[model samples]
Target: MNFGERLRFLRNELDYSLRKMADELDISFSALGKYERNEHQPDFETLKKIADYFDVSIDWLLGRTQEGYDHAIRIIDNAVEKMDPNSEVELYIPPAILNEMILKNIDESHLSLIPVYGAANGMLNLSESNIIQYEFKHNQDMPEESFFYIISPDDSMKGSNIVKDSKVLCRSLDIVDKKNLEEGKIYLVSYQNSLYIRRVFVNNQDQITLQAENVHFPPILIHNMSDINIIGQVQSVEFNPNEQK
Candidate 1:
């Protein structure tokens, strides 16, 4: 069923009148009618409000999945109930494992996979490492080929919410031109064969300044930009550590 059909079904299931639903949602009756008729699509905020009111996941409202919020809650509850508090908990499970559990019966052609690199104690040569693949839903605007994952080496960027040992999703700068570099943005950089994550500052001269979020680590200045290798831009991070057993 489409979004409109689903919306109408939800309202009917709740036994709410059109006027009552509209008034409760703080939207015009005509707008609600338009949504039900599929004549006009509600904005993201409106859709979120509707999801909240119906106590359903947005995925269900958008017809992405038949399973509602209750199903999701049950899944969480089941997982929690199976956990042993005294045992070491596996915090970060790669998406591939989830796919094996949930998408094993689904067609493999529709699934998209991205490389996730495990952490290395020293400088990592991406070409030499064996990467674990994880299912990823890519944004249309993202350059998928340039995307890769790395683990944060230290807590230097903790002030910026990037904690140590966290997995970071990055986009390689090989695909991005030097002129497109934005100041005050975090990037995965290579200098003197060592990897570092720092906020970038480009000056009028040929120099580039790399600043650590932690004040304890002083700002690093590279006299020539050529000396600094732009590995990639840090996009997002996931922190999940195994607690003591």
Candidate 2:
């Protein structure tokens, strides 16, 4: 794609608007509009800022090369292959974890699969105690089994879709990559010797701010250095009939 087309495409793919990009680049929206519309071009310094913002190279911006200067095109290509928007991906769930989830709730028939959409999003343990177990099996090593649970100590995520005492299920692999986090979606995260269930608000640089589904809970700042653990990406929610009328 040409410079304008590439800029527009990357901006749209990342869900950034002209105003936001302009603000970040310290330029006027009209200037950004000109660049996007091919009406004008940015100087070297401005071009550098744009390239840095998009993590691309100036050469890539000018269409001198098919790949960006960062040489991260391979990574992006791999990600695109794995994360095909048109395809439905299935997670490889182990049988042991499945049984544990059923027994943890004390209602085998009530157990259902929840689809989590974010990195830290997962099934939340709402039992009186943490009965959920993590079973790990590896080559030439005994499987490690441990039990843990998360709770939203604050009422930040009170109303909306995820409420207090909402039992959520999480996938084990969602936390590792930390790339598929969807903003405005609820997630179960482990931070500072505690487990919290909250919605994720991403600002930039893969750093996320945690917001409660309920306004009562104050928002938490999650830095990259924080020892946070994402147990699963929440896929779906299971509502128990007994809890309802």
Would you estimate the TM-scores of all the predictions? 0.52, 0.36
Model 2 regions lying over 4 Å from their true place: 1-129, 132-156, 174-177, 240-243
Residue-wise C-alpha lDDT for candidate 1, range 59-129, written one tens digit per residue: 77788974543343444454444444553433333444332323222332333345566556644446524
Residue-wise lDDT of candidate 2 within 62-172, one digit each (tens)?
A: 888753322333323333354335545433334443323321222222222222232133433434223332222211221111222233233445464444444444444
Which residues of candidate 1, in runs, are more than 4 Å off? 1-111, 122-125, 130-135, 138-143, 175-178, 204-206, 240-245
Clashes of each: 0, 28
The TM-score, computed over Cα atoms with residue i paired to residue i, of candidate 1 is 0.52
Error of 2 at 53 (Å): 62
